[model samples]
Structures are given as C-alpha cells and as structure tokens.
Target: MRFIRYVLRALNPKTAVTMDSRQVFRIRRCVVAGVIAVLVIAMVSCGVYGVKMHAQRAAQASQSATSTDKTTAKRQNSKKESSGKQSQKSQDNADTEDSVQAELKNQSASLTDDQRNEILAKAQQTARDNGHEPTQYTYCVAQKGDVGSLDDFANAVYRILNGERGWSRAGATFVQGADGNCDFNIVLSEARYMTTFSPDCSTEYSCRVDENVIINDDRWNGGTNDWLSAGGDMARYRVMVINHEVGHRLGHTDNETTCAGAGQLAPLMQEQSMHLDGCATNEYPLDGELWIK
Candidate 1:
C-alpha cells in the first residue's frame, strides 16, 4: 500500500516537478517499501518451492522403502519354502530307513528263543574254528538261458564259495578256472534245463550230479517259498543253495542231515529249498557241518 500510494503521488502533476523536503522523504519511503515488497515475494516463492520439493522427495523415499520391504518379504518366503522341501525330503529318507529296519526286526522275531540262542552259539564257535589246514579247490561257472551278467554270477559264485560265511570257514578256498580244468562245475541253469543234469534234478530246485553243482535259475532269481516263509531273502537263498549242492561234493548226503531241532537252523546238508520242516532258514554251515571230508 505504501509503495502504490507513493507511485500514484509521484505520477500526479503537483508532485512531479516539486523538490520539497516532504516529497523527498515520501520518495525514500516508497523506495524502501518496494525493496521490502521484492524481498518478501522472493522469500515466499522460495518457501513454496522448498515445500513442494520436500513433499516430492518424501513420496519417492516412501516408494523406495515399500519396494525394499517387498523384496525382503520375497526372500524370506523363498527361504522358508526351500527349508520346508529339504525337511520333507529328509523325513522321507528317515521313514524309508525305519521301514527297512522294522522289516528286518520282524524277520528276526520269527525264530524261537532257544533256536536263536543255539544259532548264536554256533556262530560264535565257528568264528573260533579258523586254524585248520586250508584246502584249495578250483571251480568254473556255466550258465544256461538269460541269467543276467555271467561276470556278476561268477563273481557272486566265487564270493559265496570263499566267503567267510560260506565253505571258506570250513578251511576250503575256491578259485575260478576254465571249463574241464576245475575240480567242480557250478552251473546256473534255467528252470527248463535243470532236469537235463539228471532226472533227480527238477525244474524248481538245485541238485548235485557227481562233479556238477546245478542251480535252478528260477530259484536263484526268486527264493524258495519255504525260505521266504522262514524270513529269508533271495541273496540268502542263493547262499543256501550253493552251500547245499556243494555240500554233496564235500561228502555230505542229503538224507544224512535235517533241522537239528524244531526252530533250529536247517543244516547246510538239509534240502532247505524243498522245505524248512519247521526250522528257520539258514545259509551258512553250522559248527558240526563245517569240515570237508
């Protein structure tokens, strides 16, 4: 108002040419008011611009913070999902191991206490029967039909013959040799060819004909019903069949031995493949049947 009033007065004809002291004072006052007005406008404009700029910066910071929070949440969720999957996989493996152990336990429980104790005692005694003269025997493997890998079969045969639990503990050491050069022939024959060895050899079982130890591929692949019923698997059935047929070569007759007692281990000379006769299925030779003639 001061600046505008002074401008109006200076523009009037009465005050335009006048040089009075009062007019000079009025001009100075108007100049000061105009300078104050310019300063006030500049301050107000800068204040408004500063407020707008501050608001825009706050909005940007808010958006950035929200994005950062989302990213953190996603990382946390991903970690949780990975951890859950790993935990579930570990749990599944543990369950499988537990299931296998439970099955083994149930199979072990099928034996009577007396039979179990007797078997354990026999095993302990056999462990001490080690210092006898070792007899070395060479054997060859022959296969009929598809019996998987012959190399694997031969390896298993050698392992069974010379294994600690097999005839090896009886002081017999076995080596694989070429055909006709071996002391005995271990044959893995198909079920159809089992009877070719002799009429006594059947399609469902293994047999010994002089120097030939014929094994039924069907029984080798699938264990006997009696053995399986007695809580034995195919691997153990193979061990029993090999030892039993070879026991014939070792001077043991089939009828000479049977299950020692009810719930006792079937002797290696027993026809365990045909029947257990209420005895538990056993593969290795017992203490009394360990020596070769």
Candidate 2:
C-alpha cells in the first residue's frame, strides 16, 4: 500500500486523476497472480527434471544388474563343465586300476613253489637222458595253478622232442626253465584258463600265441576219440599234442591235410585230436617231415 501511495504522490494530479480504489485493488491482485504463476512454472520444470534423472538412474541400474547376472551364469557353467571333465577322467583312471588289479590277481594264482620244484627236478632228469648237444633251442616251461606235476609234463615234452624221429632230427633241441630269457614258452594250462593264453583257440584246442605254446589240460588227461580209435593210448596223444604245438612255434600253421590212405600215418601238422580223417595214429613225424629250416 505504501509503495502504491508513494507512486501516486510522485505522479501529477492530472496523470493520477483516473485511478480508483477498486482499480488499484484489481491491479494488485493481477500482479500477485502473475508472480504465483511464474513460481509454479519454475517448480514444475524442476520436478520434471528430477523425474527424468530418477528414471535414467533406474534404467542404468537395471542394465548393470542384468549384465552381472549373465557374467555369473557363464562362470557357473564353465565351472560345472570343468568339474564334469575331471569327474570322467577320475572314473576312467579308476576303471583302469581295477582292470590291472584283476589281471595281477589272475597271475598270482598260478603255480605253487612245490609244484614248480617237482617240475624242475623232472625236467632236469629228462634233459640229462634226452637233451642233445648244440643247444639249438631253449624253452620256458610253466604250469597253471590247478595243473599237475610240471616236472613230469616237462619230461614228457623232452622225451618227445629228443625221440628217435622228433624235432632233434631237425637240429632243434628244447630245454625247460622258468627264466624269461627263453626262445619259446611251453605253458601247461588248465581248460578254464586256456583262453587267457590262447584267445584264438579259446577252450577247444591248444594253441601257439607268439612264442608261447599253450597246452590244454583236458586233452592231456583224456585222449581224443581219434586216438582212442587208433589205440586208446594216452601216451601217443601226449606226444601228438607236444609235437603239434611245438610245430606252431616252429613257424607252422594249421594244416588241413587228411590221411592219404585208411592205414597211413596222419600228417604231424594235422588236427589229429579233432579228427584222424581215416589215418592211423602216428605220434612221431615221418622221415623228412620235420619241415623246420
């Protein structure tokens, strides 16, 4: 009010003559309304800016959280894959260990000391009687845990090899020992374990694998039907078995030669134990039949 009165006093009477109380009141009210509208617009602009900034911060926070979640998931997946691979490798190693243990157990169950000694004694005696000079070939003799008398079997093998018309005629002499440094191995195996040494022959027949001659206990104990038909002699069958397996060690393969005549001697390389095929039983190799070079 004071500022208005001062303004009216400063003006001349003629200039202020039209001013009324109501008009002055109306002007004051208009001025107050304009100031309030300006203040309201400024407040509204500040509120809009605040809302925009808050929204931007919220969006940025959401994006960062999403990125963090993806990184964490990838790390977890990598860890799981690595763990899975390690687990599989461990399993494979465990399986290998088990297999080795089983094989060792099987080998450990083989021939006892007493049996080996008996076999050694017999082999020595037989070698004294039948072993010839020049020492052409040496063989290692081994027996399965359940097979009988390695010495007796070794002696039999020696006798056959040094017989009148045996491998000795071909200038090849065989000696028996347990040492690994032998030219060939003659293993007396039980029927149950034959396939372990001779996978090709399985259990049906004796076989030669590498330089190892595997002999089946079943055939040794009981002569085959062909041998029985000829003479029912266990001795002749033993001779045949030794010669056949040793023939394989001497670079001979399975020979399907049938007997030439009903009474002729079967070829030493023939599968005589299975079938004579109309041949007489002949344990010793015929003259010039050594075929060893």
- Give a tens-digit lDDT track for model 2, residues 25-120: 566567678889999999999999999999999999999999999999999999999999999999987986676555434323444557545544
- How would you encode candidate 1's per-residue C-alpha lDDT over 1-293 as one tens digit per residue? 98677666665658756646577668768778989999999999999999999999999999999999999999999999999999999999798657755643443344344644454444344435776666777788888777776665665665566656877677777667894898999988889988888897788788889899988888877878888878776667777888888888988888577777888888888888778888888888888887888
- lDDT for model 1 comes to 0.76
TM-score of each: 0.56, 0.52
User: What CA RMSD would you report for each candidate?
Assistant: 14.1, 19.6
Flag regions of model 1 displaced more than 4 Å.
Answer: 1-129
Pairs with steric clashes in candidate 2: 119-151
- lDDT values for all models: 0.76, 0.71
Residue 119, candidate 2: C-alpha displacement in angstroms: 18
